[model samples]
Target: MNFEDFIISPRSFKTESWQIGSRISKGIKEGSIVLLFVSDYRGVGGDAEMQDFTGVRKEFYKLSQLDFEVPVIDLGDLVSGKTVEDSHYILQEVLSACHYKNAVPVIIGGSNDFAFSLFSALNFHQKNINYTQISNIISLKQGESINEQTFLSKILGSKNFSIKNYHHLGYQKHLNETDSIKLIKEVQFDIVRLAEMMNSTEKTEPFFRKADLVTVNCDAVESFNDPFSMNPQVNGLNKREICAYMKEIGLSDNLQSVGIFNYNIYSDNQLNHQLLAQMLWYLIEGINIQRSHPKERHYEMFYVLIDDTEYAFRRDVFSNLWFFGKDENIENCIPCSRKDFDEAKKGWLNPRLMKI
Candidate 1:
């Protein structure tokens, strides 16, 4: 696929020699982090336009590149098709191309519903996908059109997609329907409240550790000055907390794709743009750090007996991350936290971990 045909080239931005943008390549490279922007917000009742991400690019390009060696590419803004479905098709092709080159595509802009495209594209390459989403609202409305309210239904209810695990994080109890929340739990899928995600990323880090795809709805972020998201809330993940989670998303061992959607493209606030740009930087930094870790890892194993059964937990010697399993193979184990291990030693187990 000649990717140029499907998207506009990013506008050139001035950057110092030490800045990250100065090191960004315009073409995709193997094992690189690719940025793709979309402006089709029709799903949320906004018209498509040739949106200028100059503000974001300018801020991102100016940040320090540090010692990171991972290749980064700017594929530019994706061209909105005549129809929303057309946009999805084009995005799927572009995402597939990136996957073919072993690159991770971080999609920016567009309505949150475009996440369906990310899922479809990855589903074609692998099965049993582990998807994690950070959003303030949970809607399961049934509809033919793919909008923010009905897209989750389409993904979870669809017979064609093979989702091994799904985690919905940062959802507010007041914003979500009781039935929808109950339904998600009845299926044994993980759904975390906004309170559980505040201050620290330790408990939630495990959710991102093995995810194959992750998406963030900007509505889940708290707005300041001008609105930060299309559907901004007064209470949501603050700037620091959101950046911490972005890094966790990047540190995923099995990460394949990511989407940051429902952003306020019309915001003129420099701080909002800077926040978004820094979020991307933190994500890239986490990816670089994860890639730098040794392929062969060492773990300290501990066993806890509960109700006549023994459970195993392992702690990584290098990263100090924890995992739970019944054996020594890390691949067969589940990502966990120190809190989980402590609770286990007290003869208590997290039901969610048992379900997985």
Candidate 2:
């Protein structure tokens, strides 16, 4: 399928040298970032209007680049298909193309089911995919088809796809079903509650630290003026907190794909668009900053004996980032928080290390 038939080019660009638009185009630079906008919302399992991303691009293009050297390309809006599955197929093709070229794809999405397309394309890239999601609800119940409610179930249960680790962040106890939460624990998947991430993004940072694909449900965001998501919750992360998390998502050394889903395009709220645009900007900024880290090996290793077991910690002397080693070797080290390092001395098994 010719990609031009499915993607309309983004038109927004600013005259300022520091504007993000200055770096966006159709060209695919190796190791660069590519943006895809999806306007179709049929997978939402309700009467949904096709989203208009013109305001989002306008706001994003106007933001200062902060002298970032990272390259970004906006491939424009995805054309809605005759069926929701048709849309998913076209999206999978596009994502696969980006993956083959070794470019990071940042998807501004139509619904949560878009993740199915992202997950499907990921199979072509590599095995043992580490998928991470930030959302306020867990809707993994089996449905008639792949929609927002059953996308996670489709991904986790798919025989063709191989997901090594599935991490759920920002989940609220009230919004999630008891059975689904219990099922997650029974499977031993890593899940962090909304209350756990309110003031401390650090606890959640480790989740994103090594993630391959990260998806954020916009409903997880709290908006007062107008509902920014289809299932907007009364309590969720604020703009600043959400943006900070987006930066963390971008900083991932293994991050390859991302999606921001459930934005209520039916509403004419500029604030909602502005916030989403800024969140994307922060993500790009973070990718640029993370890439600038020195490649030279400057690790400082510390070993401790706790409860008859020896634990090893390694710190990047340059970036001050900490990692918990499975053994003495740095090659097996897993990204961890400074707090995890502190707790290791107290004989507490840094649970984050087990996921590695």
Candidate 3:
């Protein structure tokens, strides 16, 4: 069967952008992993004609030629009908298929709303799924419209899913509405402010550890940095900085999947596409690194032979190697018990590097 037959473009513009045939051929030759590439038409409307996919198709074909194998699947046509609920159902079907096949889903949509169906799918498959989502907007008030402010809000407003496992990263003061802030706090999200995210790397570490699935909305990049995104902002991180965080987080051995959304062609210049491609490259590179270096090392226990004291104490090394203890005090070297020790071993740690 033809692999391109499975490819669905939501709009003429998206089809025009793809290089499907060559991409499919190269993907097959490379024995690449299956990756769903959902492309959407801009605006809220009915099904549109499948236009010529020359520009974007060439890019996908070129990307398929990389040494790594990646079979490109499409779900752009699933969002049919006038209701947002229809788009939601289409997203669910696409993601459910990905989940069944153990494939990664890469969605490029008209707005951040593309994530709602995926979110709903996770909700449906709640027993077997875990989500780690990141968005700039904090919440969607009851009557908010689908313009620039309410994109993330709509997802937030959707009722079926629980926000207990959600992680809201890079929230800006100016962009979020007052009601959104209240709702975010009410939902108990681990909010990592844009300033705090940039202030220190260690401080932002918790957000990365919270999930198996990670979603990045392109608008998270600073307005100046990613002019092409739907709603760019002055306070957000730049493309390089955001991509670095993605790389570092993707290095985590626990990540199951990832998605990038809201990359409107009309929003920016040609530079946006290049930036998006680079960000994706970072993600793929990060996953490759994690796959190669699967094992995470830690000092299980230190058999310190204290000759002067005439005792060979088996002190359990609870923390990672980098732990220098809380401050410069030797008292912090208290022996760790089994329960506490297991939690400390979550990430890689080097000797002489411990902090609060």
Which candidate gets the maximum TM-score versus the true structure? 1
Q: Write the per-residue lDDT of candidate 1 for residues 172-211, one digit (tens) a residue.
A: 9988889999999899889999999999999999999999
TM-score of model 2 (CA atoms): 0.94
Evaluate residue 162 in candidate 2 and report its C-alpha lDDT on the 0 to 100 scale. 90
- 152-211: candidate 2 lDDT, tens digit per residue: 999999899999889999899988799999998889898889888897688778778778
Candidate topping lDDT: 1
Which parts of model 3 have CA positions greater than 4 angstroms off?
Answer: 1-6, 9-82, 126-130, 143-164, 199-202, 224-226, 295-356
**TM-score to true structure, per model:** 0.98, 0.94, 0.64
What C-alpha lDDT does candidate 2 achieve relative to the native structure?
0.84
Predictions: Cα RMSD each? 1.1, 1.8, 9.1
Q: Which stretches of candidate 1 lie above 4 Å from their native place?
A: 1-3
TM-score order of candidates, top first:
1, 2, 3
Range of the 10 consecutive residues with the lowest summed lDDT in candidate 3: 304-313
TM-score for candidate 3: 0.64
